[model samples]
Target: MGKLVDGIWQQAGYDTDNNEGRFVRWDSSFRDSVETDPDARYPAEPGRYRLYVSLACPWAHRTLIVRALKGLEEAIPVSIVDPYMGEQGWSFSDGRDCIPDPLFGARHLHELYVRAKPDYSGRVTVPVLWDRRHGSIVNNESADLLRMLNRAFDAYANRDLHDLYPAERREQIDAVNARVYDQVNNGVYKAGFASTQAAYDEAVGELFCALDWLETHLKGRDWLVGEQLSEADIRLFTTLIRFDAVYHGHFKCNLRRIKDYARLEAYLERLYAIPQIGSTVNFRHIKQHYYSSHRQINPSGIVPAGPILPFL
Candidate 1:
C-alpha cells in the first residue's frame, strides 16, 4: 500500500485523487535479470535465488504458475507472505504455506527491501526475486520475474522448454498481454479502487469491452498468442482465475463473470488441468487478502462466503 521514495520507506495510501479519482498503478522499480554466466554477479544457480510472494496477488501468482510449470520448484525456493497486508505492508506469518525468510530471517517484507537498499523507496510488492548470494533483490516485478524464470535457470530446470517468447510469437504475445493487462488484469483494480463515479464507469466499460473481445477471439483458439501455450496465456489466467470468486463481487467488477463466458471459463479449466497450475491457486488466500487488506473498500473487514467456484 506504500512505496519507497528516494530509497526511504514512505507510508502513503493509494493515490486515487489524480485522474479524476482513478487508481493508477505505479510501475515496479526493481528490474534486474539474473542470466546464465559463471562469472556474473548473480548467476543462474540452483538454490541461490528465492521468491517472496503473496498467494492473494494475481501478479505474484504469475511467477508461481511459471515456477510450477517449468518444474523449478526445487531450483528456486519460495516464501509466502500473509494474506492480509497491514499498514506495514506484507508480513510473514506462521500459517501453513507461509515460510519465514530463510536468508535474512526478517519478519516483515519491507525489511527485505531495506536490506536490499537501505534507502530504497517504492511500493513493496511481490513476487520479489531475492538473490541470497548477493543479499539483495534481483527483481520484484512479476512480468520480469516470470520471464527470468522461464529461461534464466535452464541449466538447472527439469525440462528444457523452448523460448516462451518465441521469435514469431513475440509480437502477438506482446500485443495481447498489453491489452489484457490494461483492460482485465489491472482494470478490475481501477474500477474497485476508484474514488469517483466517472473513474469507475470508465474502467468498468474498458474491462467488459476487452472481455467481450477475448470471448470472441477465443472461439476456436486454444491459447492467446501461439498455437502452443505462452506467457500471455499465463498472464491472463491469473486474473481470470480470480474474477468470479474475488473480482466479481468483492472488487465490484460485476458486469459479467468469467463463468458467464463459455470460452474463457473452459479456457480457465484447461489451464487449471495443467499438471501444477491448479496447485498454485489458493482461493482462501486470494479472498482473505483483498477483503481484509483493502479496508477502504470494505470497512467492516468481513470476508464473504458462498460464491463456490468449481475450481475450488
Candidate 2:
C-alpha cells in the first residue's frame, strides 16, 4: 500500500489522519483511451494492449471479467501481480499461473508506471491497460478499461455482443451505478478504513441502507437497471462477491453479511453461475491479500479459514 514519487517507489502507509480519519481514494492518473476509430491514436488492434492486474483487487477484476466476456483473451494479454501488496506495492512473483512482464521483465508494478511516465507521482494501481506499441499506459481506471474492452476491439472480438451499455438503458444504468458505487462499492471501503467512529458509523449506515434498498429492488428483478445484465450488475457483483469473505471481517463491515440478504444471496449466486464471471474470482488471493496486506488493520497478519462461500 505505497506509492511512486517522481518515478521512485516509496514504502509508506496511508495518511488517513489528515482526512479527518476518512479513507479517500486517490483518482486514477492515466485516462487515455483506445477508440475504434481509425483516426484515433490508439486504434483497436489485436495484441497491441496488455493488462496489468491483481486478482485481489475488485477494480482490476472488473477488467478481467470484461476481457473474458468480450472474448479478448487472444486479442489482449494480461500479467497478474502478487496478491500481498507490501511496502513496495504490487510485485510479480516467479510462480506458475503468474505471467511475468515480457515487455520489461520488471520486478515491481511501479516500474511499469515509471516506464510510462518517469515523473509520475501517485498510487500505482492495477488494471493498467498498457499500449505495447507506444510503450505507455493507455488507462489505469477500471471503469474506463471495462468500457474500452467492451467495444473497442469489436472488429477482432470472437463474438459480437452489444448492449453492455445500450443506448436506451444508459440513463438508468448510469444512475444505478453512481449510487451503487458511492453507497455500496466505495462505501464498504469507507466503513472498513474509517479511522474515527463518526466516520465509520456514517459509512456503515450508508452501506447497509444501500444494501436494504437493493435487497428490496432486486426482489423480483434479474438485473440492476435494464431487463438484461449490464455494466451495473458487473460493477456491483464484484463487491458483493467479496462482502462476506473479506470485507465483513477484515474491513469491520459486519452489520450483516451478504449471505444474510436472501435476495442479494440469490442474485450473487446467479451472477456467480456465469461461466466467465465465476472463473475470474480467486478466493485464496482475495482473502490472503486483505488480511495480510493492511498491516495497520490486522497487525497479526493471521488469515482466517472459515465462512466458506457455498456458491464458490
Candidate 3:
C-alpha cells in the first residue's frame, strides 16, 4: 500500500488525512503501449513481454482474464506476487503460488518499478506489462493492458478468441466500463478506506445503487455489452467475484452479497463457468490479501471462512 519516492521505496500508506477521509487512487504512471507495428517502441511479439500480477488484485485480474481469453499465456509469461502486502509492498515469495520475479530476482515489486525508471515515484501496482527486450515496463494500467492484450498479439493468440472490444460495441462498452469502474470496481475500496462515516456512506451508497442497476440491466442479457462478452463484463466480473468473499465483509461492502441479486448471481456463475475465466481466480489469495493487508481496517488480521460461494 506504500509508494516510492525519488525511486526509493517509501513505507507510507495512503494519505486520506488531506482528502476529507476519501480515498483517491493515484493514476498509473507507465502508459506506453505494445503494438503490432514492429517499428513501435514495444512491438507485439511472443516471448518478448511478461506480466507482473497479484491474483488477489481486481485491477490485475482484468489483465489475467484478457490474457487467458486471448490464449496469450505462452506469448506473455507471468510472475505472481505474494498475497500479503507487508512492510514491503507486493514481494516475491517462493511459496503460496507466488512466482518470483525471474527477470532480476528482486525480492520486492518496487525494485522492478525502480528498474523501469530510476527516479519513478508512485505506487508499484500489478498487471505490469513488462518489456523483456527493453528491460522496462511497457504499461501498468489495466485498462490499457486489456486493450493491448486483446489485439496486440492476434497473430499469436488463439483463433477462437473473443473480440472483447469490438469496433461496433466500443461505445457501449466504454459507457458501461466507466460507470462500473467508478461505482463498483473502485467503490469497495473507497468505502473500506474512508476514515469518516460520511465518506463511507457515500461510497457504499453509490456502490449498491450501481449493483442494483446492474442486477436490473442483466436480467435478460447474457453480457454487459452487446450479445457477446466484452471488456465491460471482464472488468466488472473481477470485482463481483470478490464481492462476497472479500469486499462484502473486509471492505464493509455488506449491504448486499452478489448472491442476493438473482440475476447478478446467475450472471457471475455463468462467467465463472468459462474455463478461461474461472481458472484465473484464486480465492485463497483473494481472501488472504484483503483480510491481512489492511491492518487499519482489520487489526486482528483474521480471515473469515464462511459465506460459502454459490458460484464455486
* Model 2 error, position 144 (Å): 0.7
Who is ahead in lDDT, 2 or 3? 3
Each prediction's total of clashing residue pairs, residues at least 3 apart in sequence or on different chains, is 7, 0, 0
Model 2 has an lDDT value of 0.90
Local accuracy of candidate 2 as per-residue lDDT tens digits, 1-312? 788889888876667899888889889999999999988999998998999998989999999988888888999999988888887889898654577788899998999999999999999999899998889999999999889988888888886666598889889989998999998999999988899999899999999999999999997799888688899999999999999999999888898999999999999999999888999998888888999998889998989997888786
**Cα lDDT of model 3 by residue, 149-225, tens digit:** 99989999865777899999999899999999899999999999999999999999999999999999987899998
lDDT (Cα, tens digit) per residue for candidate 1, span 1-312: 666776666679988886789999988878899888888877899998999999999999999988887889999999999998987789998987788877767888999998888887778889899988888999989989888888888888887666777878888999999999999999999999999999999999999999999999998999987688899999999999989888899878998999899999999999998877899999889889998988888888889995987765
RMSD of each: 1.3, 1.0, 0.8
TM-score of each: 0.97, 0.98, 0.99
In model 3, the worst 10-residue window by lDDT is 155-164
Q: How many backbone clashes does candidate 3 have?
A: 0
Best by TM-score: 3
Residue pairs whose backbone atoms clash in candidate 2: none
Q: What is each predicted model's overall lDDT from 0 to 1?
A: 0.88, 0.90, 0.92
> What is candidate 3's CA lDDT for residue 125?
91
